[model samples]
Target chain A: MDQSRRFTQVPGKYFLIMKIKLELFGASRDLSNKDFLELNLKNKSSIKDLREKIINYVDQKFKGNENLRKIIETSAFCSEDNNIISENYQIDKDQKIGIIPPIGGG
Target chain B: MLHTKIVDLSKEKIKPENAEEFIASSKFGASIVFYGTVRENNENKKVTGITYDSHDDLVIKSFKEIYNEADQKLNIKEKSVYIEHVKGYVGLGEISIIIAVACPHRSEAYDLSRYIIEEIKKRSPIWKKEHYENKESEWLKGNPIQAN
Candidate 1:
């Protein structure tokens, strides 16, 4: 977990930006070709924001992979404690979050 | 005793007997063992092997959760369980997972075993990539994790 600071414009004021590390798995890893991704997000960003950021990142980097984007949309985020975090859950500190895609195991 | 492991093929392999031995108990009359294996073909494709990928820590955690759920839901008593899933390449006819359960009676033993496996499939953070004889591999589509 690491944090970096930046300034991003909000509706009336500027918000602090923080760096969050996302540990990718399965199809997300295959598409991104990276085990992890460092994303800059607004301080105290929600999981929804992270989802949007990831989808946006893929939309730009992969250019035309609709399926990959769809996978990210349905995927869920897991906390360091191995519990799935709700979309409304806010992130206020640095954490290594895991991106879990659809699972097929016995 | 509850035994759970994510067997890494490079270092070790899953043994069904080990699961059986762990769950064997004199207090239980019925013991059910389930072994999931890789087949030779799928959807008319010639399959060679399968590579299993998993979030190691989450997987073990999920297994414990499933076991606890099974114990309470099924009202199992004097029960013992053993669960092991593979984490690497498994060729055709090789064991990919093992689930063993021992309960006071046959009915609960069956129920507990089924519940554990089904829950694991839905809750565990694991994926399977199938390798075909055509030298092609594809990740099998699975149910997405529920994000509340």
Candidate 2:
């Protein structure tokens, strides 16, 4: 699913935090060594926001790994329909999203 | 028959005969079949195998899109195409992908086959990690995905 329905109360603000599921593929999967990653962000975030979070995550967890960071930066997010979503597209609900890196197939 | 498939090697192997049989017809004069297999060496590395990973649903969607794009670009309405790519580990000399096409002319068949494969390489969400003799592996670089 894209985001978990369970929301958390922000300490200062009243907005809920959404838990999102990002499916990894190709180099992204290889670098992360995971099939998918769960991210928590503010409700109604956009694909661009997700990208930043992923970059930050890679930076913190895989420090000095420029290759992984570059892959995440160059990647695009895909919706459940398998179409690449625009960076401005909002992610307000639960759904499984895919992180598409560069592709090489015969 | 015009189709695309993301084959799971553990469940079934890709067969050339199946593609040939599916594309066989009296109306078509030429058929082109391309099979990609694991090689023994690449970039000076003694390659042992390849692990192909893919987003199944997206790969199938990309295949359909590539086929449709091919049809529009080539203006070939009447054709038969069968495309399959493996989705798991493949050893040396094992088949990784197959693209079979049948058309009214040899040149069209060749062009169509070439176009489809090229587009799939750029559009499909599939990746390959090469396993080498030294037990090391690396994912090959590819074209970046563009937001649709």
Candidate 3:
């Protein structure tokens, strides 16, 4: 059988690709009009790696301001389903990430 | 119901003209009021004036949450609570937040009033910018503390 046909024929043996969608808000929103970011990975990427990728993207976008970086480091990131994942949590490929800035001002 | 408003809390007008109405409407024997004012000094800087800013929606939401938490913990009726905060620039000696709580007794009112202020300071996202005498301004983070 062909590779694609054999994969399709196998009920649960085929590898499933995982994709993550990221959304940014607040000062992070100001970083880019590309409001939605997507990352495709195998099912094994840890949430910590996802966070590192996000931090790198943010760092590249906003080169200035150590304060902003520190603030982002401390800010919380949530799944689109509103699950609070620890930085080290493993992320499924099809999961969604929401980046939330630390809210300031009354 | 608790009443909350965002305004430029002013000391000159701190005594609301309708104070009599608010006092009269309360059946509680004790009504405690707390006025938080802007001081002339912050940290070691001479503050000429202070500008208060907030994400109004979030701030109000947080304030309401704090108010609700107080009500739940204290079991106080909705009618016995009132909280107001200043959102814009408030100069020296201006009132920033006014909290009034009425309870059947003096102790509850006093305790609740203090608790509300403390919680608001710790949780509210409101920030203050201190304008120094030397024409410098600094953003103050977290809660305000009494000058040493």
Candidate 4:
């Protein structure tokens, strides 16, 4: 299999136009504490598509961590307005999105 | 009247000189203050220092709720209350929490202060990290009973 074709199978690279800022917390600090990457999504990218992009990207970066992938899958994305947008939500251009882990503090 | 304020006593500088003035602002005849300090011993273990952390928004909201409940339950009118909890690190003998209540009488002030502290400990979302002499850290979920 070609590397480019395999890359598409990963989940983190699906977005083409909207920029996102991913923050790390707790055990996620091991992967990339300051791993904020910007991706420009193609116009009218749905939330489901963007989540696929994220999964692909993270899969490529981490390679063998199934646990991290599960965490990413279960995690929710918060828009700039603090709204929890599901993986299938539509993405708007230049929107600031945050991927947050489960908050466990009392 | 009921008044309450919760502050980050660790990072934010608290002026001790103004403490008396602030706690005695109302024309109350008596004011009681309770200071909770970090000690060197916990559960028979030598402690170095303690680190406290909390969700800023949630802690503040919880403190407000507790304060309101105290006011309503005690029917404390013409009284003022102050509460502060340390965030970050607190050394031995450093005050981690402070509660002051002023009322027209000493008994009421004492009772109110105790009630507020107990409720804050039971209800607040603040967590404490205890650093022991062996360089070990343990997270305490709720306030543990202390020996006077």
Off by over 4 Å in 3: A1-64, A76-106, B8-15, B18-20, B143-148
- For candidate 4, what is the DockQ-based docking class? incorrect
Taking the tens digit of each residue's C-alpha lDDT, what string does model 1 give over A1-106? Answer: 2222467677888877777889988777875567799998878999999999988888788884788888888999999887899999898877889999999987
Which lDDT tens digits does candidate 2 get at residues A1-106? Answer: 3334565556765655777889988888854557889887887999989988988898788884899988888887899877889999998876788998888877
Cα-lDDT of candidate 4: 0.62
Task: State residue A15's C-alpha deviation in candidate 4, in Å.
Answer: 12
What's the best-to-worst order under DockQ? 2, 1, 3, 4
Across B1-148, the per-residue lDDT of candidate 4 in tens digits comes to: 4333345654475444445566776489998878888888979999999776654444566667776776678777667777666567788888777677778888878878888777766545456668999888865433321111
- Report the Cα lDDT for residue B16, model 4: 48
Please, what's the RMSD in Å of model 4?
A: 8.8
The runs of at least 3 residues in candidate 2 whose Cα sits more than 4 Å from the true structure, single-residue gaps closed, are A1-11, A31-34
Q: Which ten residues in a row have the lowest lDDT in candidate 2 chain A?
A: A1-10
Backbone atom clashes (below 3 Å) for every candidate: 0, 4, 6, 26
The DockQ for candidate 3, computed on C-alphas, is 0.11
Interface RMS deviation of candidate 3: 9.1
Candidate 1 TM-score, C-alpha based = 0.92
Chain B TM, cand. 4: 0.84
lDDT of 1 at B55: 95
Which consecutive 10 residues in model 4 chain B have the weakest lDDT in total? Answer: B139-148
Candidate 2 overall lDDT versus native: 0.86
